[model samples]
Structure formats: C-alpha cells, structure tokens
Target: MIEYSTLKQTGRFIIILGIQILILNQIHLGGYITPFFYPLFILLLPFQTKGYVVLLLAFFTGLAVDMFSNSLGMHAAATLFMAFFRPGIIRLLSIKTEFEPEVEPRIHVMGKVWILTYTVMLIFIHHLSLFLIEVFRFYELGEILAKTIISAGFSVIIIMLTHFLMGSARKT
Candidate 1:
C-alpha cells in the first residue's frame, strides 16, 4: 500500500493532470500556446525519489494527458524525455549543500533561482520534444521553436504559481 503522504501526493498529481487536460489543454492562444501543468507533478516530486519511479510516474502522467488530448505519444514522449534528464539538471544546479533525498524541489526550499532554473530547463526539453514530434519535419524548425518557447513560458508560470499557492513553500 502506498504511504498516506504518497497517496496524498498522488491525489494532487491527479488533480493537476486533470486541470491540464480538461481545462488548460483547450486554451491554445493563437492556436499554439497551450499551457501544460501536468509535467509539474514530475518536477515537484521529491528529489530523493528513485530514477525508475520517477520515470514510471512521468510516463503514466504523460500517457494520461496523451489519452485525453488525442495527441498520442507527444505528451508521453516529452514527459519521459524530461524524466530521463531531470536528475542531471537537479544535480547541475543543486547548491553545494547536502540535502535529504526526500526533500521536494519547492520554491521556498531551493529558492526562486534554483526552482526557476530547474523548471525552465526541464520544461524547455519537454516542450522542444513535444513541438518537434508534433511537426515531425526538419523544415518547420522555426514554427517548432516558436511553439516550444511560447508554451514553455506559459508552463513555467503556471508551475511556479501553483507551487507557491500550495502553501508548501517552507524555506529551509
């Protein structure tokens, strides 16, 4: 059985994924800038989480979105792609201080710069994979780049706002 706290976390993940698919996915600004918050679930997961666990969560989360959005592997691929790199990015930007493995990457815990840098990097990787797979052609590189940038900006904002609003910003 999943631990109580882990269950609660799972519930929150489901809620955020729902919001992304049922609401945000429908709002494409100028037909391109669609907000994606589901990836934040993966981003917000505890830093100590095992790599395979993270990959599994990311795959299912993106798969859930893919099923809803009818985009078939785009969300899953991008999310899984980010999952593969999340550990590296965290290590690269993590301050030279030791931390418990279970500490979450919340804004207050890591500070705004760390949070922002981490989110931006992963979101960009996710979005780039998403948009590139979407176009599926090298010729439309400009369009893919634009879509990735605009969508990533929107995603980062939502992730940060939601992270703070959750009242979990305990700066340690």
Candidate 2:
C-alpha cells in the first residue's frame, strides 16, 4: 500500500502543476515577471529522498510545464539544474545543524530565515537558468537579468504565501 505521505505529495504535485499550467502561466506582469511557484514542490521534498529521485521528479515536473508553455525544454533544464544543486545548498544552509532525513524544508518546520534563504537561492537559480535558456543571447543579458530578478522576487513571495497557507490549512 502506498504511504500517506506519498499520496499527499502526489496530490500536491498534481495540484501545483495544474495551477501552474492553468492559472499562473496566464499571468505575465510587464512581460518581466511570471511566477513559477511550481519549484516549491521540488524544494519541499524530504531530505532523505535520493538525489536521482529528486532529479527525476524535477525533470517530469518541469517537462509538464514545458508541454503546456511550449517553451521546449527550458523548464526541464532549469529545474534539473536547481535540483542538482539542492543538496549542496541544504548543506551550506545547515552547516551548523543537521536536518533529519525525513524533515522537509518547510517554512514552519525549518524557520522563516532558513526557508527564506533556501527559497531565494533556489528560486534565483531556477529563474536565472530558465531566463538564460529562454533567451540564449549574450546581448540580451541585461533583459534576462531583469526578468530573472523580478520573476524570482515574485516567485519567492508566492512560494512563501503558499507555504503559509498550506501549513495553516493542515493545522485545521
């Protein structure tokens, strides 16, 4: 039988992807900001999850979005890059303390500062890689940077809000 956590995560994966493809993908602020809170799905995975498993999940998650957005493999590539560095980032952030194998990188569980730093770093990496892949032009570096900064900022806010809402909802 499937574990409860497995089922829960599967449901969340579907929901987040649905929202990204159906709702958030439609929003483009000044053509510079498009929130991709879908990365939060990857960020929230359990610490014990194998690196290969995380990479596979990230690939499929981003591939799903790419299929909808028709941006080729930009999402998949960006997400893969982010997932590749997730473990190192976690280690860097928790240099003084060790996280439990099953502990997820959630704001309430990990504290605001840690979660903020974690989310910001990963989101920036994902955004920069994504925008760079999308543009693929050295001359447009400035525009890409602008988009990455603005989009990462917005994505971080949405991710934090989603975490708070999910955390509170789970309490009741």
Candidate 3:
C-alpha cells in the first residue's frame, strides 16, 4: 500500500505540474521572462529523499512538461540535471550539519540566504540547460544568457512569493 506521505507528495506534484504546463506556459510577462514553478516542487522535497527516486520524479515531471509544451527533451534534460546535482548543492551551501529526517528545504530550515542561494543556483542551471539546448549555438551565447537569466530570476521571484504567502517557509 502506498503511504499517506507518498499520496500527498504525488498530489502536490500533479498540481504543480499542471500549473506549469497549463497556466504558466500561457502567461508571458514578456518575450524573455516566463516563470516555471515545477522546480520548486523538487526543491522542496525532503532532504533525505533517495537519489534514484528524485531522478525518476524529475524525469516524469520534465516529460510531462515536454509533452504539453512540445519542447522535445529540453525540460527533461534540465530537470534531470538539476535533480542529479541537488544533493551536492544542498550539502555545499547549507549551514546545518544535521537535520531531522524528512526535513523540507524551506526558509525556516535553511534560512533566508541559504534557501535563496540554493533556489537561484538550481534555477539558473535548469534555465541555462534548457535555453542553450534550444538555441544550439555558441554565436548566440549572449541571447541564451539573457533568456536564462531573465527566466530564472522571474521563476525565483514567483517561487519566493508563493513560499512567503503560503508559509512554506516553515520546516516540514
């Protein structure tokens, strides 16, 4: 039988993925700045979550987005890269040497600066992988950089706003 926590996590992933594929894709604040929140779901996963499980979920999430957006494998590659790198990033940047099992990566647990830095770094990587793959050329490196930076910044703002408003700042 699936555990209750697994059920809850599945639901959360579905809702966030739906928002990304349906709502966020339709809204363009500009030509360059489109917010993606699906990464926030992965970012908030329990600190001790198994690596393979994270890779699987990130794969599914990216595949879902790719299906809806018809962007081929761009989302899949980027999200998978982010998932693969998540643990190292957390360990490298986090202040806490120890955490309770199932600790959620939130501002309350990781503090403002730590969480902010963590989120921005992953978002930048995801965006860079995505935009650079789409562009597929070094000549337009400047454009790729601009798009990645703009989209990542916009995504960070949206993620932070939601966390503060919903009190996702709390440790879970």
Candidate 3: lDDT of 120?
93
lDDT of 2: 0.89
- Worst 10-residue lDDT window, candidate 2: 95-104
Query: Which is the better candidate, 2 or 3, if ranked by lDDT?
Result: 2
In candidate 1, how many Å is residue 4 off? Answer: 1.8
- Estimate, for each residue in 19-120, the C-alpha lDDT of model 1 and write its tens digit: 987899889888658888888899988888888999999999988998988888888889999999998898889655456766788866778888889999
What TM-score would you give candidate 1 relative to the actual structure? 0.91
Task: For each candidate, give its TM-score against the true structure.
Answer: 0.91, 0.93, 0.90
lDDT of 2 at 122: 95
Worst 10 residues of 3 by lDDT: 163-172
Best by lDDT: 2
Q: What tens-digit string does per-residue lDDT give for candidate 2 at 11-89?
A: 9899999888899989989864779979989999998888899999999999999999988789999999999999999
- Candidate 2: which pairs clash? none
Candidate 1: give the clashing pairs: 48-101
**What order do candidates take by TM-score, descending?**
2, 1, 3
Instruction: Tell me the spans in candidate 3 whose CA falls farther than 4 Å from its real position.
Output: 168-172
Error of 1 at 85 (Å): 0.6
After superposing candidate 2, which stretches have Cα over 4 Å from the reference? 96-98
Better of 1 and 2 by TM-score: 2
